[model samples]
Target: MGGLIFIFVQVLVAVFLCINFMLITTFFTKEFFYTTMRYILFAVTLLSDCVILIVTNLLIICNYLKITMNLWLCAIMFILSTVYSSVTPFTLTAMTLERYVAICMPLRHGDLCSTRCSLHCILLIHGLSSIHFIVDLSIYFASTSIKFYKQSMICNVWIFILYRWQDHLRNAIKTLYFLFMCITIVFSYVRIMKAARAASGEDRKSTWKGLKTVILHAFQLLLCLIQLWCPLIESAVLQTNVKAYINLRYVNYIIFYVASRCLSPLIYGLRDEKFFCAMKSYLLCGFYKKKNVI
Candidate 1:
C-alpha cells in the first residue's frame, strides 16, 4: 500500500513538472516577457529545475517498481541533477541581487543587470558549483569502498554523496555553502528593507513594491532551504539503516523533490506580475480552446 501510494504521488509530481515546463516555455516564447534579464534567469532556473524534478521522480518511481535504477547513465544523470540543483541557489541569489540593484541603484541597473550579464552570471555559478559534482565523480571512481545502499527502493543520488563519499566533509561543506548563501540572501533583503524604510515620503509607494518583492524572494528562499536542504532528509540514509522506516524514505523523496519543484515556479516565478499575467492569459486561452473542441 505504501509502495502504491509512493508511485502515485511520484507520477503526480512528474505530471506537475511537465505542466510547469510547458507553461514556463510558453511564458518565455512570448515576446512581451523579454523586458528584462530576470525573466531569462527565471526561465533557465525553471527549466533546469523541471529537468531535475523529472529525473528525481523517475528514479524514485523506478526504484519503487523494483526496477534497476543503477546504471552508468544513472550516474551521469545524478551529476547533472547535482549540478543544476547546486546552481539553483546561486541563480536565485543572483536574481535577488539584480532586483536589489534595480531598486536601490536604478540609474546603474540599466548598465549593470542586462540579459547578457545575467546569463554570464548563471553560467559562472554553474561552473563553480560543478566542482562538487566533479569531486563526487572523481571520488566515486577512486574509492572502491563506496556502494549504494539498495536495501530499499527509490535510490536518490544524494544518498551516495552522504553514504558513499567522504560524507562528513561533504556534509559540512554543503551545510556551510547553504549557510553562506542564506546569509547573503538575508543580507541582500535586509538592505532592500532598509532602503524601503528610508525612502522619501514621495517614493514610499514605489519603494514598497520593491520591499514586497524582496520579501517574497526571501520567503521563497526559506522554502527552498526548508524543503530541499533539510539535514534530516539529506543525511537520513546515513544516520539510519535503510531497512528502518525504508518506506518513509519514499515520503522524504516526495516531500523534498516534489515540494521543491512545485515551490520554485509557483512561488518564485509567478511572483513576477508580467509573467503571471502572461501565464494566466496563456492558460485561460488554452482552456477555452479545449472547451470549444469538446
Candidate 2:
C-alpha cells in the first residue's frame, strides 16, 4: 500500500514539474526577457526546483523498484536537496531586495536592479548558500560510514538529514544556514512592506502595486520555507516521541514537493499578466493569438 501511494504521488509530482518546466521555459522566450534580471532569477528558482523534482522522482521510482542506491548517488540526492533549500531563500531575499528598492528607493532602483547588479546578486547568493554546505558535506562524509545507507535502498535525502545532527560540523552548518536565510528573508520583506506603508501622494498608486506584489511573493516564499523545514521537523518529532508514525516523513516530502513546485508558480507567477499570457501562448503552440502588452 505504501509503495502504491508513493508511485501515485510520483506520477502526480512528475506531471506538475513538467508543467512548471513549460511555464519556466516560456519565461525565457524573447518577450519575457524585457525584464531581464527579474526573469533570470525567476528562471533560476524554477530550474532549481526542476533539479529537486527530478531527483525526488528518481529516488521514489528507485524505492518502488527496491533498487539500492550507492552512497554517491544518495549523497548527490542529499546535496541537491540542500542546494535547492538554500537557493530558495537566497533568491527570495534578492527578489525582495529588488522590490524594496523599486518601492522604497525608487531613485536608485534602476542602477540597483540593473542586469549586472542582478547577476552579481545571483553569484553572491549561490556562493553564500553553498559554502557551508560544502563544509558540512566534507565533514559528514569524512567521519560517517555509509555502508548501511548503500544497503537500505531508502533513496531519500531525509536519510542524510537524520544523520547530520550527530556530526557537530554539519549540525552547526545546518542550523546556522537555515537561521540566517530565514532571517534575511523575513527582514527583507518587513523592510519592503514598511516602505510601502510609508508612501505618499505622488507614489501612492505605484507603492500599492508594489506592496501587493511583495505580499504575493512573500506568501509563496513562506510556503516554500515551511516545506523546506518539514524534513527537519519530522526528524525532531521522531526523536522525541517513539509513538510518532514513521509514515509522516513521506507525508512531509510529498506535501512539500507538491506545494513548492505546483502551487508556487500558479499563485505568484500568475500575477504578471505578460508572463501569464506568454505561458498561454507557449502551451497553445502559436495557434493562439498573442495578446498585446498595452
Candidate 3:
C-alpha cells in the first residue's frame, strides 16, 4: 500500500510538472507575454511552483528510499523549498493588486503595471520571501551546535528546528504573514466588487471577471495557508493511530502541497483566454496550423 501510494504521488507530481513546464514554455517563447504585467507575474508564479514541487518531491523520494543527506545540504534544499513556498503567496498578492489596479483604476493600470514595475514586484516578492529563510538561518546558527551541521540525517524541516521556541516562532510568523496577505486580498476583492457595481457594458464584464479572479486568489491563498497546520494535524493523528496517520499524511500532502500549486496555473493560465489560446497552440503545435489550412 505504501509503495502504491508513493507511486501515485510521483505520477501526480510528474503530471503537474509537465503542465507547468508547458505553460512556462508558452510564456517565454512568445514576446506578447513579456510585455504584459499579468502574464509576467503568472510566469513567475509557475516557475516558483515548479521549483517547490521538484524540491518537495525529491525530499519525499529521498525519505522513502531511506537515503540520508548531510545536514548542511539538507538545510540548503529546505531553504529553497521554504523560500519558494513563500514566493507563491507574495506573488499571488502582487497579482491580486495588479487586477485591482486594472479594474478599479484602469487609467493608471498601464503606468503602475509596466514591465519594469512588474519585474520590480518580482524582485520584491523574492526579497520578502527570503526574510523568513534569513531569520531562520540566523536562529539556527545561534541556537544550534556546529557539530550537527556535519551529521547525516533525513532532510526534513523539523531537523533544523532544534528548539521548541523555534516552532512557536514559526507559527507566530506564519499567522501574521497569512493575516497580512488575507487583508490585502480582501481589500482588492472589495474594491473590485465596487468597480463591478459601477461599471457597465464591457467595463462591467471585465470588472466582474477581475472580481472573480481575486476571489480565486483568496481561495488559493487559503489553501496555501492551510499547509501550516498539516504537521500539527498529522502529529495528532499519529498519536491516535499510526495507520490512519500514514494515510492522512499522504492525503494532506497531495491536497495542500501538490493541489494548491495547481491552482495558480489553472487560475491564470487556463482561464485567461489569450494565454490559453497561445498555450493550446504551443501544446498542439502544427495541429492548429493544419486545421487553419483546411
Candidate 4:
C-alpha cells in the first residue's frame, strides 16, 4: 500500500510539474509575457509551485523508504519545502493585487505594475517567505546542541520541533502570515467586484474576469492554509484508527498540497485565452506549425 501511494504521488507530481514547466517555458519564450505584470506573477507562482512539489515529494519519498540522514541535511530539506510552500500563497496574494490594480485602478496599473516592479515583487515574495524559515532555524540552533546536528534522523519537519512551545510558535506565526495574505486577497476581490458592477461593455467583462481570478486565488489560498492543519488532522485520525489515518494522510496530501499547486496552471495557463493559445502552440509545435501552414 505504501509503495502504491508513493507511485500515485510521483505520477501526480510528474503531471503537474510537466504542465507547469511548459507554461513557464511559454512565458519565457514570449517576450510579451515577460513585460506583462500579470503573466510575470503567474510565472513566478508556477516556478514556486514546482519547487514546492519537488521538495515535498522528495521528503515524502525519503519517509516512505525510511531513509535517514544527518539532522542538518534533513533541516535543509524541510526548510526548503517550508519556504517554497509559503511562497505560493504570497505569490497568489500578489497576483490578486495585480488583478485588483488592473481592474479597479486601470489607469494607474501600468505605472504600478511595471516589469521592474514585478521582478521586485517576486524578490520580495521570496525574501518574505524565507523569514519564517530563518526564525525557525534560529530557534532550532539555539535549542539544540551542536552534536545533535550530526545525528541521523528521518527527514521530517517534526524533527525540528525541539519543544512543544516551538510548534505553538510556528503555528502562531503561520496564522498571522496567512491572515495578512487572506485580508489582502479579500480586499482585492471586494474592490474588483465593485469595479465590475460599476463598469460596462469590455471593461465590465474584464473586471468580471479579474474578479473570478481573485476568487480562484482565494480558493488556492484556502487550500494552502488547510495544509497547515493536515498534520493535526492526521494525528486525530491516528488516535482513532491507524488504517483510517493512513488513508486520510494520503488524501490530505493530494487534495491540499498537490491539488492546490495544480490551480496556478489551470487558472492562468489554460483558462486565459491568450496564454492558452501560446501554450498550446508550444505544446503542439509540429501540429500547430503544420496547421498554420495549411
Candidate 5:
C-alpha cells in the first residue's frame, strides 16, 4: 500500500516536472540567454529526479512482492537516492544565490552568475554529491555484519550494522555536511531577509519577491531535512518503534518530494507575472482547442 502510494505520487511529480520543463524551455527560447541556461538546469534536475523515482519505486515493488531485492538493485537505489538528496539542496541553494545577486546587485548579477560561472557552480555541486554517493555507497556495500529486525507486517528486514568507530566517523561527517548546508541556507536567507527589510519606495515590491524566494527555498530545505534525516536520527538515537517510524517517515518523504517538485514550477510560474500570464494563456488556448475539437 505504501509502495502504491509512493509510485502514484512520484508519477504525478514526474508529470508535473515534464510540464514545467516544457514551459521553462519554451519561455527561455523566447527570452534571455541566461534564462535558457536556467531552464537547462531545471530540465536536468527534473530528469534525474524522475529516474530516481522510477527506479526506487520499482525496488519497492520488488520488496512488496516478496522478491529478494538484489544487492545490486539496492546499490543502484542508494546511489540514485544519494544523488537526488544531495544534488537537490545544492541546486536549490545555487538558485537562491542566483536570485539574491540578481535582486541585490542587478548590475553585477550578469557578470557574477555568467554562463561559465553557473556551469562551474553546477559542476561543483554535482562533484560534491558524487563524492558523498561514492563514500556512503562504498561503506554500505563493504560492511559484512548483519542485524535482523522485523518491520511492518508487509516487510520484515535485516540491515547491516556499522559499529566501527571509522564507520561512525563517516556517518558523522555525512550528517555534518547536510547540517552545514542547512545552516548556510538559513544564514543566506537571513541576509536576504535583512536586505528585504531595508528596502524603500518602488523597490519594496521587488524586495518582497526576493524574500518570497528565500522563504520558498528555506521551506524546501526544511522539508527535505525533516523528511530525510529525522527518521534516521529518531531510530538510531531514541530506539523508537522502527516500523512505525519508517512508515511515518516514508509518508512524509513522498509528500515532501511531490510537494517540492510540483511547487517549484507552480510557485515560480505564479510569482513571476510574465510566467503566470503565459501559463494562463497557454491553458486557456489549450482548453479552447480541445472544446472545438470535441
Candidate 6:
C-alpha cells in the first residue's frame, strides 16, 4: 500500500512539474528576459523535481525486489533532497532581490539585470549549491561505512545515517545557511523599503509595488519554512511530544507542495500587470473566436 501510494504521488508530482514548466516557459519568453528570472527559477525547480521523481522510482523498484540499496545511492538521494531544499530559498531570494533592485534602483536595474550578468548569476548559484553538497557528501562518506550482505540474488545493505560528526555538522551548517539566507533576504527588502519611503509622487507608486513584491517573496519563503523544516525541528525538539503536532505537520506539508505548484503563476500575475493582461486578453480572444465559429 505504501509503495503504491508513493508511486502515485511520484507520478502526480512529475505531471504537475511538467505542466508548470510549460506554463512558465510560455509566460517567460525571451522577450521578457529581465522579468523572466522567476520563470527561469521555476524551470530549474521542475528539473530538480524530475531528478527526484526518477530516484524515487528507483527506490520503489528496489523495494519491490527486496533489494537493499547501495550506500552511495542513499547518500546521493539525501544530497539531492538537501540541495534542492537549500538552493530553492536562495533562488527565490535572488528573484526577490532582483525585483527590489528593479523598483528601488531603477537607474541601475538595466545594468544589473543584463543578459550576461543574469547568466553569470545563474552559473554562480548552481556552482555554489553543488559545492555545498559535495563538501557535505565528502565529509559524510569519509566517516561512514557501508555493510552489505548478498543472498537470494539480492543485496541487503545496511546504512547508518549518522557517522562520526557528519549529521551534527550537516544540521549545523544547514541551519546556519538557511538562517543567513533568510536574513539577507529580509535585509535587502528592508533597505528597498527605506529607499521607497524616500521617493516622491510617481516613485511612491513604484515603491508600493516593490513592497508588494517583497511580501509575495516572503510569503512563499514562510510557507517553505513552515512546511519543510518546521515539522522536523519540532519533531526533534519535542521528542515524544511530537505526536501532538503530527496532524499540523501533515497539513502544512500538503499545503506547502500545493502552494509551490500554484505560486509561480500567482506571483507573476500579481506583480506583472502587463503579463497578466496579456494572458487574459489571449484567453478572451480565443473564447470569442471559438464562439463566432460555432
Off by over 4 Å in 6: 1-19, 28-30, 34-76, 144-160, 227-252, 256-261, 277-294
Kindly state the number of residue pairs that clash in model 1: 0
Deviating ranges (above 4 Å) for candidate 3: 286-294
How much lDDT does each candidate structure score? 0.69, 0.68, 0.89, 0.87, 0.63, 0.61
lDDT of 6 by residue, 216-259 (tens): 77787776665436546655756766444544433443366545
Quality of model 2 by C-alpha lDDT: 0.68
TM-score of 1: 0.81
Highest TM-score among the candidates is held by which one? 3
- Cα lDDT of model 5 by residue, 1-294, tens digit: 566665665577567657766665545544553444444455445555565556655555555466654455455566676676667767777777777777677798878888778788878877877775576555655764343222222221123324465446645755776687777777767777777778888677787787787788778766666554554554674465656654665565566665665555655656767666766776787799999999
How high a TM-score does candidate 6 get?
0.70
Which ranges of candidate 2 are over 4 A from the true structure?
Answer: 31-35, 144-175, 194-203, 227-229, 232-246, 288-294
lDDT tens per residue, model 2, 9-35: 877877878877777778777654646
User: Worst 10-residue stretch by lDDT in candidate 6?
Assistant: 149-158
Off by over 4 Å in 5: 1-45, 140-171, 233-246, 281-294
lDDT of 1 by residue, 1-294 (tens): 676767677677768777677767666667655557777677766777777777766676676666754545667677877787666667777777887887788899978887678667877888876877787767766754435422333455754463533666656666676787778778777887778888878576667776676666666566656644455664566566655455566666566556655666765456656777777787788899999999
- Report how far residue 265 has shifted in candidate 3, in Å: 1.9
Candidate 2 displacement at residue 244 in angstroms: 7.4
Give lDDT: candidate 6, residue 221: 74
TM-score of 5: 0.74
Q: In terms of lDDT, which candidate is stronger, 2 or 6?
A: 2
User: Predicted candidate 3: what Cα RMSD to the true structure?
Assistant: 2.5
Q: Comparing 1 and 6 by lDDT, which wins?
A: 1
